[model samples]
Every structure is written in C-alpha cells, then in structure tokens.
Target: MTAPAPAIPATGPTPRPPDTGARRKVGAGLLDPRQLLRALPGALRKLNPVTLARNPVMFVTEIGAALTTGLAVADPSVFGWLITGWLWLTVVFANLAEAVAESRGRAQADSLRRTRRQTTARRLTGWEPGAEPSAYLEQDVAAAELRRGDLVAVAAGELVPGDGDVIEGVAAVDESAITGESAPVIRESGGDRSAVTGGTRVLSDRVVVRITQEPGESFLDRMIALVEGAGRQKTPNELALNLLLVMMTFVFLVAVVTLQPMAVFSRDFMAAAHDTAALNADGVRGIVLVSLLVCLIPTTIGGLLSAIGIAGMDRLVQRNVLAMSGRAVEAAGDVNTLLLDKTGTITYGNRQAAGLLPVGGTDTRDLARAALLASLADETPEGRSIAAYTRREHGAGDGEPGRDVARPGMTWLPFTATTRMSGADLPGGLRLRKGAASAVAAWAVQNGGTVPAGFDYAVTEVSASGGTPLAVARQDGDGPAQVLGVVHLKDVVKPGLRERFGELRRMGIRTVMITGDNPVTAKAIAEEAGVDDFLAEATPEDKLALIRKEQAGGHLVAMTGDGTNDAPALAQADVGVAMNTGTSAAKEAGNMVDLDSDPTKIIEIVEIGKQLLITRGALTAFSIANDIAKYFAILPAMFGAVYPSLRAANVMGLHSPASAILSAVVFNAVIIVVLIPLALRGVRYRPSSADALLTRNLWIYGVGGLVLPFLAIKCIDVALVQFVPGI
Candidate 1:
C-alpha cells in the first residue's frame, strides 16, 4: 500500500505575538484608564443629545418654561415665575441624573475590557533535530528555515502558537476560557498524543512544539471569536418595542404641547389683575394644578421604565451571560417558541462512531480501514472520530509506523460542499467512497444495482434516529458498484439536556429542532429530546422562514445557532441566542451570547428576563398609583369646587400650598427610593419548570406592587399631618 500523503496545509495567516511586555503593562493601567475617562465625554455627548432631542415631553416642557420665564421677566407675574421655576427644576434634575447614571454604566464596561487585557501572551521559540519549527516564533520567522532542536521561548498565558506535538515541559492551561467547559485542561510535552489550544495559557511549563497546523488559523482564534462575538444581533421584538416607546413618548409630548394654551387661559385672570394678595393665592393654586396634571401623565413611569431592564442585564452578567441588548432579555421572557440548531447548540458537535456494519465480502476490519483511509485527510469532528476509532481497532502504535506503502490511485475526490462525499482511487478502477446514505444509495441505483440488504437495513435503522449514517461503496472499472457497509455517527448529547428540556416544556415554550441533517435523523433526535416539533433538511433560509411563520402566529421565537450559515435565522428571530462555541458571524447576528455554551444558561436568562418584566410592570403600577393619588389630592383645588365647601380645618387641617407641594414631592421621591431596592431584588432563580419560575416572579412583583403603594401613601399622609398641623 502507498504511504498516506502529508496532511493538507492549513489556510490563513500566522498569528503575530501580541506585545505583552512593556507597552502592554503601561497600556493596561494608564492608557486603559485614560481611554475609559475619555469615553465618558463621548458617551455623554451621544446620550444627552439624543435623549434631549427625542424625549419630546421633556424638551417641550423645558422650552415652555423658558418662554414662561421670559414672560415673567417682562410682566413680573408671580404665577409665571412659579411655573417657570418648577418646570425648569424638574427637567434639569431629571436629565442630569439620567446622564450621570448612563455615563457610570459606560465606565463600568470599560473597566471590564481592561481586566481582560491583564493576562499575558506566551510565545515559543527554539527547536530540535528532525523536529518541526515552533508555532510561537515571531510572525516573520519562516517555518522552512528552522533547524531541528532549536530553543523556543513561550510566554506565560499566551496561546499555543500552532498545532504541534509537544517535546518538553508541563502546564495547566485554562482552555475553559474558550471551550465553555469550566475546568482548566492539563497539557504535558514530549508525546505524539498531546495537543494544545493555540491561545491557552502556559501556566508553569517550558515546552517545544512540532508545528502541525500553520500559524494564524489555529482553533484558538476561532474559539475566541465564537465566545466574544455572540452579542451582535438585535432581535425583532426589541426593535418593535423601541419604536413603540418612542412613538408613545411623542404622543404624550404632542398632547402636552397642544394643551399648554388651555392651561394658560384657564388661569385666574381676574385674580392676576387684582391686589397682590389675590395674585399670590392664584399663583399657588395654578402651580398646584399644573403639578397635578404633570403627575397624571405618568412622567414617573419613564423613571422606572428601564430600571427593570438594567437590573436584569446586571443579573445576566453575574451569570456569565453577556446580554448585549436589554431588549433581548425582555424578548426572551416572552418566547413561546424555540428553534435549535442540532450541532453544538444541542449536540456536543463532536461525533463518534458507535458501530459499523459490513456488506458483500468485506469484514468489519476492512470496513474500518476503508473508512479511515477515506477520512485521513478530513479534519472535522466526525473525521477525527473515525480516524481515532480505526487506529484503536487496528492496534496501531501511538506514533506513526515506519511502513512504506504505494499510492493506490486512479484519482482521489476530496469532500466538498456541493458533492458532500469523499473517495479514494484504487487499482483495477475500483473507487472506495463514503458519504450520506441517500447520496450513496442514489449512486448505486444509477449504476444498475441495489444497495446490499444488510447495508440498506443498517442505514434505515441509524438514519431513522437522528444518527448520521455514512455508507461505503466500491465501483469497479466501468461496471456497477457494490455496497460495503454503513457507519452510524451521532453527536453525544450533554448530560443535563433532558432535565433542561423538561423545564423548558413546563414554561410553555414549544421546542423545535431545525437541522441540515436528513429528516429521518432529525425526527429521531427530536423525539429523544422531547421537542414539540422538528424540521429536517433545513437550510439557514428555511430556518428563517420557519421563525417568521411562528412569529406571524403571534409566538415569540428564540432561535439558537453557532455558525455563519445560521446568522440570518438568528437575526430574524425574536431573541437570537448564540452559543459561545459558535462562529464569529453567528455571534454577530445574535442578540445575546452564552459565554459558557450551556443551554441551561438560556433558562437562567429567561428567568432573569421574566424578573425584569415583572419588576418593570410592578414599578409602573406603583409609580402610576402614586400619580393617581397626586391627581386626587389637587383635583378639587384645580376646579375651585372643594376649596369653598370643605374647609382645610375640617378635613385633616393640612391644606396649605407649601404643605401640599411638599407632600407630593416627598411621596414621589420616597416611593422611588424605597421600591428601587425591592425591584432590584426581583427574585433569585435557579433552573426549574417554567411554571414554577413564572409563579414565583408573579408572587413577588404582584404582592410587592399591591403593598408598597399603600404603605408609601399612608406613611406620607401621617407624616404630613404631624409636621404641619393647621392651615
């Protein structure tokens, strides 16, 4: 037999060592801090200008007050002065507080980036005789020029420079930072069996690598991008709600602007023209009425609107979920439908051969050898698994055996996206090929033969249960083909998937599997996972259309994926959740990215989202309740109806102008202070049935909403009565 050809060259540029010495140290502290501080000005400029321009109610109120201030200066009316002063104070303080809060949030984000840069990069140099060059050499170093056994220096915590066999030393590397696995993987040198992650840390070992893969295209870079880029896309629900909120604010401002003249005309004109005593009394009453109207319109709702969202986002960060958009969390809570890509997201994305079936005159050993040869040049998880299995079965030693073999050839056809098959050319015009059963079966039928009975049986059995079925066949020099056997491959499911799926079901979410795999296999896995539905042979385009169909039915869909092909569907979903193990393109198309790549993180996020919505809903009710009371407090006075009949001494003897204004402001501010902490506490959640989670959130937000307003109002009333007794 011919010796196997050298491994295919890896595509992409070699990675350059990040400068982690002098400049990096300085940049970490001084440069990072200065950049963060500088970002504040830009952030402020971006936020304040937009908020001021877009928040019509605030802008109109400020503009109206300026006009009123000018009128007061010209006419010197006490009423104009009070209106101008009160409105200006409210606008100025509210806007300033909001700006400060947002700026602080941005500063916190900057700090996180600086923390990540503190870790150092390790670079390797040197070599050995007959050994490959080290991957950690400087970018300009040519691989062909290096002699064997040269010394290579690798830095601390830097990524491994290339795919290489280790020659020396040992280290505990944190591969979990990229792998989504929580534990650090241990690496040791001097063996053909040892493998290193390109970007992982060296910890405490000095080692030399025999470069296997070329420089820049290491798995480490791909993994890092997968983890970090998961937060790029905006969900449809978020986009819609944002537009709705903006429009609602606009409507409120329009009403305020149109009604301003009526308020001005309704003022006590006669009292204004009379003596100073009457004017002072009218001014106080006018101020009270305006305050009441402003309170009625739910201005306080805006204060708590994003409070729940921000709190939820903070909680997600704590759980290692970097939610890029607050709107994504909100959308997650409302997801009635979920679509999952089979690989990586649901399956481990690593395939292993469970068993092999033989056909015609071939035995299992022959089947294994052919499979191994066909897979020798492929580097996918499936191919690797086949190669490893073949070596183990054949009792091949750890290192490559020194056996000279001739090339068996007519022509070798590599796997491609279009063909979806691979083959090796043999003497006597025999071609050994392996691929999807359907494709191979079609080829068999076209060449005037049926697939062997055992082979057909094995394909039907494995393919029906979501297992990838690979069929092997041999075609003679210009005649028909004979079927060999089938290899059944399935992704190993994560341990906790069943329980997580159960929880999701209880939450009323209908889970659906969408995969490029055959329908037979898709259905089998869907049944095993307890999915509500399955779509087999789904392309990315098909996935997007399915998501739109579900959304059109009024179901909020959460789609999870981890490849460039999945980007469009992820972007189209109501909440796009990308795995930390996904491609950079997929990550950029997702609204939220799971840093740990745990599906359970999706549950955690959903609970956080529910808490946010409940908290915001409760706060809205509480803020509005306070406004309701404010309206009632000044309603009779505004109409001049109760002022005559119900004297102040009769009712609680607390009806003075200063007393009323103080009570309203104190009540509003106090409720905000007291409820903020409670709202922030929303709920502590763990993975559980959706029903149980939702019930818990409802109980907290509901009861808190009911009790807080009563306690707040009663406390304010009693305080008012004690502090200022008679009018």
Candidate 2:
C-alpha cells in the first residue's frame, strides 16, 4: 500500500483517571428516600384544585377538602376537622407519586449534560493529513454554541464538541456517559466507525471531525430532552387508561350524587326499624360522598401513570441504552423474534489464521509466504490477522517471501464479494491469491494446474469443522497457476452465548442467526449458540428481506447491527438495537443503541419494557380493586345510622362515622408511599408465557388489591378509635 501515515504525538489533552470508561451513572431512582423527601413539598403544593383538576380522581378529593374545611371552621367537631385534614393529605400523596417519576428522568439528564461541557476545539480552516500544531488554531467555545460544518481537531482526552463524522485520523472514544458501558471503542475515518457522538470523550490519537449537527441538534441533546420529559406526551396505553379513568369518574359521580336522595328514601323506609332518631345533618353524607368518589375513581393509578412511563425511558438511559421514544421501549416488551448476526454479535469477530496447510508439493513456509504477500496491503480484519500470523509463525518480515524483498511497482488486489479473492501482482510477473477455497481452486485448475486428490477433502474438512478455508494460489507471467495451500481462519464463538440465547428462548423470543459465511460454518455456529434458526451466506439484502417477512407476519423483531448495510433492516425491525461500537448510520437508523455493545443486553431491555407495563397494569388493578373495599367501609357508615340494615355491611365494625372514612382515606394515601419502591424498581418478572404472567399479576394485584385494603382499613380504624381517644 501507500507508505503508512506518520504517527502523531497524543499530547492534546490528558483524560481524567476515572473518565476513561463511562463515569459512574449513580443517581437517585424514584424510590430513594432522599428523593422522596425532596419531592414532598412540591407534591403537597400541587394539592389545590387548580393543580389537581387534570386528574379527575384527585380533583374530587380537593373539592371535598375545601367543603370539609368550611364545615370544620363553621361548626367545629372532632370528626369534621379530622376528616377534613385527611382529605387534604389524600391530594398530596397523589402528587408525590408523579413527582418521584419525573425526578428519575431529570436526574439522568443532569448526568448526561455534565459530560457535554464546552472544551477547547482545535479550529481548522481546512483539514489536511499532515497539518501541524501551527496549521490549526485552538479556540474555546461552548458545546451548545457549536454550529454545523465546523471542522475541529479533537486530541486525546478531549470531549467532542458536536456530533460529526471523522474526516481524518483514528482514535478510541469512551461513550459511557450515554451508553453505560465503560469500554473505549475505536473510531476511524472511512467505513462504518466514522461517526462520533458529541458527548463522548476521545481517549487516544487525534481526529479531525467535520461537525454534522449543531450544538442542541445532536443525538445526545435529543436524548437528554427525551429523558427530561420536554417532549413528554402520554403513551398510547396511558391515554387509553386516562380515557377509562374519566369514564369511571363520570359513573362514580352519577352514582354518588344520586345516592343522597336514595339515602333519604332509605331513611324514611327504615325510620321505624333503625336508630333514625339519633342521626342528623347531611354533612356526614357530603363528606362520605366525596371520599367514595376519590377512592372509586382509580386515583392510585392515575396519580402514578405518567411517572411509570417516564421511569421506563429513564431506566433505559441509566443502562446506557437510549430509546428514541417511550413507545420503542414498550415495543421491546413484545419482541417475538431476535435476528442477530454471527460476527461480532454472536462471535468475537476476530477471524484469525490458525494454521496453514500446504497441498501437492507446496511447503508450509511457502504457503505462509504467499499468505503474507497477499494480505500485506489488505485492510480487512481477516487479512490483517493472516499477515500477523505469517510474521509471528513463519518469521516473515514486512516484505515479499525471498531476498530483494521490496518489489518495484507491485500492486495489491483487494478482496471483493464478487471476486471472492485478493492478492498481489509483482513487477517480475509473479501473482499471489488467497480467499475462499472454491474460488482459488477454480482459478488454479483454469490455469492448467493439476489439483491434488486431497484438495476437495481439505476444503470439506475445514468447512465441516467451522473453520473458514482460504485457498492460496500463485502464477508466473501468463502461464498456468499452481494451488499453494489453504489457510485455516478460525473465528471464536463468544463465551456464554449459548446460555444467553437459552434465556431469550425462555422469554418466548426465537433467536435467529444471519451471517455471510457458508451454510456449513453457519450451522456449526448456530448449534453452538443454541439459536432457533440461522441464515447462511446472508447478504445485506437478505437481512432486509428477512425483517420485512417477519414484520409481515406481525412478529415484533429485534436485531443488533453495526454496519451501514444493516441500517435498512435496523430501521425496518420493530425493536432495532444498534451496537454503539457499530457505524454511525446503524446508530442513527435503530430506535435504540446499546452503549455496552453487548448483544445480550436486548434481554435486559426486554425485561425493563415488560416491567414498565406490568407495573402500570398491576397498579391499575390495585387501584380499581381498592374501590371495592372503600365502598364497603364508607357506604354503610354514611347511611348506617338511618338504616340499621346497612350497618351489617360494615364488616369493619368501625367505632364512628369519622373513623371509618378517615381510615379508608389514610390507607389510600399511605399505599402510594408503600408502592413507591415497586413503581420505581418495577415488578419482578418471571420467564413464563404471557398468559401465565398475566394470571400471576392479576392474583397479586387484583385479588390482593381488594382483600388487603379491607383488612388495612379495619386495622387503621381500630387503632384510631381505641388509641387516639377521639369520637
């Protein structure tokens, strides 16, 4: 190849010791006690009808608190004042639930912004490979003020100021601030790894970046906005739940308002049979009316609904995976098939020359010499690995096999998918080729060379064992070529892949492997990894076609990719998780990008998505179920004095009208505090079928929600009347 570019000194900026990997993403989740304490005042302040009106359930409580306050002030009684104060606490508790959820996203945004601070950029008038320190002027600018198309040189340990494409040089970038993984990944000019995010830190070498986006318009900025809820809109499920809550509120309002007249009718009907002589005033009926509406209207879920959605997106950010929308996170929960590539994703991707096998009269050293010459200028990973192997194993230097090593006017033929081979042509009319075994064998036989009887056997043996066989050939002038030998390229399957795929299968996701390798190699890898299926010799077009076919059948497909060829498929898939170590195009195309570059991280993502939905569904069941117990505790207490027959329905045996109402309200408020940890941490997930998970959650939240409240209300009422020395 052309002479290697001169190496430059890495003296631009020194990285902080701890900043090499992702800075620790430590922050308060919604459940932290300190976070709760900080949010209490804002939650309490939002208890007014103006702040609470959007939530129909909490707004009813506000109205009840206002009316009760007036009654407590006008005609003071221990029960009237006590009921009024508890009604106020009811509104505050609902506000606290939402505040805690918003806090998580805000905390993540703060952490991201810290990594995006303004740094000195070496401003360049024009980029040149050999530009010196004097050719570029160092200038300081705020990261937010950076404009698109600005060319800046970023050295080792410097933060990238804007999202851009690397126009020159190569370096490793630490992207942990955005993707929670701590590893520093290589970014170079040309090919897929050229794009650089604005907030990531450069760890080594210097790159001249051509800014592709303005300061606030970068991917990281948009992600920060998403986390902070600046673009917050209710999710589809949340909107549906809201509509349902409004309908439920309307039904409860009609039932509660008309019940007063029904209670009056009950009073007259039971006037002779019950203790109607002792009961007086409709004030108790009014207070109990508001309490029943607040409890029946799904208040617990409505209060924490927005927080649940925000926390899901926030959880993704904390894990170093950024989702373009909250909906994508939800879709991940429903992914049915996972299409992953064999290289880099399933295997380590470092295909190496394990051994060289000479054929016919060819010597082992001669085979290695041919491999080294063929791969001398080759840039592909497989080529570089072969060159290194020849140097280490055969003691070959940086030249052709024999003496007079440097050949004049030698040209390298790069390997292409169409040609299926690469080699060097020397000025002395010497030709060397190495690539797929089949292509090399055909060329040798075409040039009148006799093939060894074991040639086919050698190729078959290598393919069967999963080792890629690259056959080497040589030619002199216009004469026939001779087949030299075969290079055994061994690619390692990543450790623990089989177990992870098993976990995905347990989660009801079918894992499929797609690769450019032959069917024999693909089959070997598929068996070792335990994937449900595999597609061999898969081109980029094949990848796109498979995604479309799966989507046609209504399967939610998720895949990890790192190449520009993968962009279309990633865009087409339901849940496209691009590896951060992949190209910028892949990152931009996919809905989510994994910072850690771990393919199995999709499992964690799927778990987080499922947990979010489960948390919402469980709390909803709990909220509606709680209304059942509220009616039992308060309805009879409201009309029990006038209609003694209704008193039997008071299974709580509450000591007073105020105590029963107060106890139900107390349980409603405290339950929000009790489930805060569950809301933030999310419900635990079990790898069972959808039907089984639904059945289990329903029992925990549905039946338990109904049963637990009745017992809790009774206990609170007993404690209040017996220990507090009040009515």
Candidate 3:
C-alpha cells in the first residue's frame, strides 16, 4: 500500500478566523511618515549646507578662524576677502554636485515609469490598447462590473488586467513579474490548475480570461500589500548598525565641543600680548587646534560610507539584476541555499511526449488518439505536448478533427476545482478525461483489469527518470472502461544547466528543486539537474514550508519560480529572484528581477552581489581607518596648546593656521577624487576566479587605505609650502 500523503502546511497566513472578518486598511503613496522624516533631513542637507559649502560646517568654522586671523593681522579687510572667496567656491561646487546627483536619480525613476506605462490593461467592454488615460479608465470602470465569460484581452507582453480564467487561446505568460518566479508559464483554458494573474504578460499569443475577482480585490493588490508590508520588519543587522552610527556621531560631537573652548582661550591669551612674536605663536597654535577638531569629527566617513553602497547598487543594475533594496543585494551574496521551481526554472518548461506504451489489446495509434482527445481542451505544457505528438504521428490536422470517443455530445465542462478533470458531452454514452496518473490508475483498477504488463513497466521506468506518466483510456459500451495505453511526459533540461549547477555547487550553494510532479519523476530530474535536494509532489504550501525551514536553519535562501503558486514562497525566501519574463505578481514579490530568464543568470547575479558587498565593506573599512588617523593626528594638537609642556611649534612653518585650513580642504578633495576612481573601477570588474577576486579587493581596500591618507596629507603639505612663507 502507498504511504499516506503528508499534510502540507499553509504557505502564507491562515485565513482570518470567522470572528475577524474585517480587513486591514492601508494608506496610499510610497513614503511612510517615518521614512519621509528620515529622508527629508538628508535631502535638505544634500541640497543646502553640505552640498553648497563643499563642507558646510568646516567652511563656517574656517570663516570664524579667518576673522580671528584678520583681527591678529591688524588688517580687518583680509577677513572680507577670505570669507567672500571661500563662500563663492562653496556655492558653485556644492550646488553643482547636488544638482547632478538629483538629476541622475530622477532620470532612472523616469525610465522605470516609462516601462510601466508601456503595458495596457484589458477591460470587459473591449480591448484597451496603449498607455493612454482611456486605457486606465477602461480598466478601472470595467474592473467593478466584470463577470464570468467576460473576455479580457491580454496582448503580447502586456500585464493581465485581472485574476481570471482562460477562456480562449494559448500563451506563455511571465507570472514571475508578480510572483517572483524566474520562468514563464504557458497557460491555456480547461484545467483546474491553470490561472492567469493580473500584471503578468501574455508572452506569445493573445489570451482571453474570464474574470474571477474584482480588479481592486485581485491578487495584484495583495502583492502590492505584501511588498509594502515587508518594509516594517527591520533586519537585525541593519538596526544594530544604525544605532552604532548614531552613537558614534554623538560621541564625536561631544569630544569636539569639550575641546573647542581650550583652543579658543589659548588663542585669546596670545592675542592680548599685542606683539608680532605672540601673533605668530597664536597662528601656529590655531592650526594644530583646528586639525585636532577635524580628526575628531570623522569627516572621511561622510564621504565614503554611502558612496560604497550607491556604487554597489549601480553595479547590480548594470548586470541586469535590479536590486530594489541594498540589504537584499548584500543578503544575496551570503545565500547558502536556493529553492527553485521544477518546470520553467530547472527545465526548459516545454513538455514533450517521450513515448506511448499500449495496454491489453490496444494499438499504439489507438492509444495516441485517446491521449489526444483527452488532452485537446486541456491547457498545460505536458498536455499540449501529448496532443501535438499525437497529431504529428497520425498526420491529423492541427485542430481536433476526430470525434472525442470518451465524451459524446458533450459541449463543455470547464475544469473546476471539484472535478480535477475536464470533460465534453457528445453523443451516446462517453466521457473523455485526463488528469493525475493515480486517479486514472484507480479508475482502471475498478474496471477489474490491470494496465498491460509492458505499459505498467514503461510507466514505472519513465517515472524513475523523473518523467510524468499520464495514462490514457476510453470507456466503450454501456458500463466498464477499457484501458488503452500510457503516455510518458517529460520537460527537457535547458542547455548548460548541468555546468551551471556544478559551478553553483563549487560556490557552496545548495540547490533544491520543488515541483508538483510525483516523487519518482522529481528524483529523476533532480539527479539529472544535479540538485542537492528535491521535494516532489509538493503543493504551494509545501514549497513555502521548505523555504522557511531552510531559512530558519540560518541559510540565506534565494527562491526562483514563475507561477502564482510560487509567490508566497518566493516572498518568504531571503532573496526572491524573479524573472523579467515572469508574472507581475512574482516581479513585485522578488528582491531582484533578472531581465533574462536563464537560470544561469542567477550565478551571474550572485557573483555581482558578492562584488557589491565586498566593495561596500572595503569602502567602510577605509573610511573608518581614515577616521582613526584623523583623530590621532588632530586630537593631541587641540590639547597641546593648552598644556605648556606639550606645546608644539611651527618650526617648519607647516603648522601655521592658514596652512592647516588649506591642507584639510585639499585632503577632503583628494579623498573624494580617489574614491571616484575606486568606485568606477570596482563596478566595471568581472572576476575570473573567487580567490583572485578576494585578493584584488583586499589589496585595493587594505593597502590603499593605509597608503592614500599619508600621500594626501603629504601632498597638502608640499602645496602649502609653495604658496606661503614664514621664518
């Protein structure tokens, strides 16, 4: 006896218990109140102070120092020249930088909007073509009135307007866009499993869907909620880091404020002497004091921290993987496991009839004819492949030309969830049906005979190879049905899949294949595809459970699928990777969307993700290193002028106030310039080997950090000597 099937847990939230019938309401618009508050300050700062002053706080501080210096020079006119010159430079460069960054961000958003507009929605009244206001109106208006039998026209490459039943035509729809699946699904009418989603594309053929739900309440809206709702949960690491940065900034500020008074008092005392010797001494003291303040402030961090992340995001986009969140991209590099759908992802998704085995006295042709008749109205790659093979073998026309012997005089029985099989009414007593193998096998057993020996063996043999075995039979006469033959269905593996799987294994990523196909077939395909694990006969819930299990084990899981059934699991995965050619639901659910549907793209994206993380980490490390050095160099100087024994002289004229101000400005500018090249070069890089990639990053980040700061300070020293002189 077969073992009892395990109960599959629900993939998503369980239905609200009867008492809680009310639905939760959410507000519209992209930015939430808290996010807006956090972003606004940064945006304003970007526009005004930081961007405008080149270094706003520093510039203001320099102005104050210059005023004091003028007071000592006994030439108050010099204060006006210094402040005016510095202010003019800051205004020009700062505004220009802010404008350029904003423009780039706006341009990218515009391109995304353009792509969204290219798609049109179908209305119940008629076909709404183009991205005009009328099309949206038609969608909104008809969305409320749509009913069953309403033909909604979904065009090639256009998102499906609503969740509906396929009434006519066949098409490959990319549900991945919505469901986070990495493959396109071929949809047709007359199967309980066939479902069309709103915001998925009709890739090849025009399709008509019978509306199932109202437009506003459709799956697309739910998907939007899922994506939007996810933002509330902060990753542990993100929260920790944010808190750390805040604390550090606070501590740095306190140090600067506490030390500032001492430096100012020392300068005041020297000014009171009213001698040339005292003025020069004060100038030297001011330089050392200001340098100390600069060190404590961690200015280098402001230049490098976010730049690394921004550069990483740009690199991902260039590789055709649009990372919606920086955290998602970072998580992808550390992914230890991947949950993949069997049909479009692991295989080519095109089912074909491998062979047919005759049962009892049935001939091969008769078996083919039976399979074709049963599959004619069905809409699945496996069913279509069987029908096509039959037509090709018997020289029948493309259309269903012969009478359907099973269902005589049957007009229609649209496949419903209760039936599990489709049927038609013709004449006499006949019922044509095609569905799960176990169901068909049970029917044959009740008929008091077994499938012929050869046929049974063939079914078992194909199932062992991971091929779905579909039994075809017809009922003749008044009561019992005669077994005809069996059809073996198989999805062809895409080219280069084996090699890519091997590469992924080398990278220490474990691949898991999940499918609704039976265990025998699933195992066969898994072995062929080199998957580390396989879960067969899985419902949508089963797939999601597996994903959660892996994630709970501390593995960062990237899930790839292209169906409505895959959406929840995709969302649950650490990195939901949707195919560009998948349904809109999948796309919205995914963290990253690949423009190309090739599974190999996953490997490429993972590598890109790694590069991004490494680059960001390196940049952070460098920025922090510079911060440490600045603190060491300048903090002592601030205290030195206050302590008589610790007073350092400007013996080489290097520690003069003017020289210190000029050096800090030059140091900041050089660091920014140096980082620009690093960002540009890092983004353009492609690694041939993991070791080489790691080594290169280490050298750039590790060595560059140690060397660049000293060179920058030295260059500033040399330039100051050339411009200013003192004995």
TM-score preference between candidates 1 and 3, better one: 3
Candidate 1 residue 556 Cα shift, in angstroms, is 4.3
In model 2, residue pairs whose N, Cα or C atoms come closer than 3 Å (at least 3 residues apart or on different chains), thus clashing, are 180-320
C-alpha lDDT values of all predictions: 0.56, 0.76, 0.55
Model 1 TM-score, 2 decimals: 0.54
Model 2 lDDT per residue over 474-554, tens place: 998888898888888877676666766775677688889998888888998899878899999998889899988988988
Instruction: Write down the TM-score of every candidate.
Output: 0.54, 0.79, 0.58
Model 3, position 359: C-alpha lDDT score: 72
Number of the candidate with higher lDDT, 1 or 2: 2
Better of 2 and 3 by lDDT: 2
Q: Write the per-residue lDDT of candidate 1 for residues 360-424, one digit (tens) a residue.
A: 76777778777766665555667656666666665422342211233535445556666667766
- As a whole number from 0 to 100, the lDDT of residue 555 in candidate 2 is 92
lDDT leader = 2
